[model samples]
Target: MVTIEPIMIKGHFFTAVTVCLPKTTLLTISNNTGYIMCGALDVGLLNSRLVDRKIIAGRAVGVKTIDELLMAPLESVTYEAEQHGIFSGMTGVEALLQMVG
Candidate 1:
């Protein structure tokens, strides 16, 4: 399980990980004002250490940086290809906003 410590990146905000899902799938919310990852790491508990996390499911690989996790050419995975399951058809800036929540 990849447990991300509760950190206030850049000191501007904190992530309230309400649900730790096994898969980062998607479902829309607030009429598209915001979106949520269906299954992800649980990080939204109070007074909790990040070490207390479990792994439900994931690929054999992981990367912490966008650059390190270079994907295939943009042409390979169409914008639509990545939208349905994991991101609800969103990526780039849109996807970043979801994570920043």
Candidate 2:
């Protein structure tokens, strides 16, 4: 199953998506500029192999829901995310604010 919904954070609008597979789920919250995702995201690949894309994204591990993902500290972030002041250990909400601020 797949679910997509609008989310409001500090008056900013974003999109939250949830994908349910056989035994695992994929979760992500995104705005126009960037996004934060669950462990399924590959921060390393975004930083290395796809560096040119300048994708601003972060990954949080052990999160089972979109709310957990938003509250959990990031395990890793893309280099482009770093450039935007988003870092590992920053909560998803904080990183998201930085993406728009």
Measured against the true structure, the TM-scores of the candidates, in listed sequence, are: 0.19, 0.98
- Kindly list the per-residue Cα lDDT of model 1 for residues 1-101, writing each as its tens digit: 33332323334232322223465422211112222222222223211443233211111113233322222111112122233322333332333343334
Candidate RMSDs in order = 13.3, 0.5
lDDT of 2 by residue, 1-101 (tens): 99999988999999999999999999999999999999999988998999999999999999999999989999999999999999999999999999889
Error of 1 at 71 (Å): 12
Worst 10 residues of 1 by lDDT: 69-78
Q: How close is candidate 1 to the true structure, as a TM-score?
A: 0.19
| Backbone clashes, each candidate | 4, 0
Clashing pairs in 1: 20-42, 21-39, 21-40, 83-89
Candidate 1's displacement at residue 30, Å, is 13
Judge candidate 2 at residue 61 and give its lDDT. Answer: 99
TM-score of decoy 2: 0.98
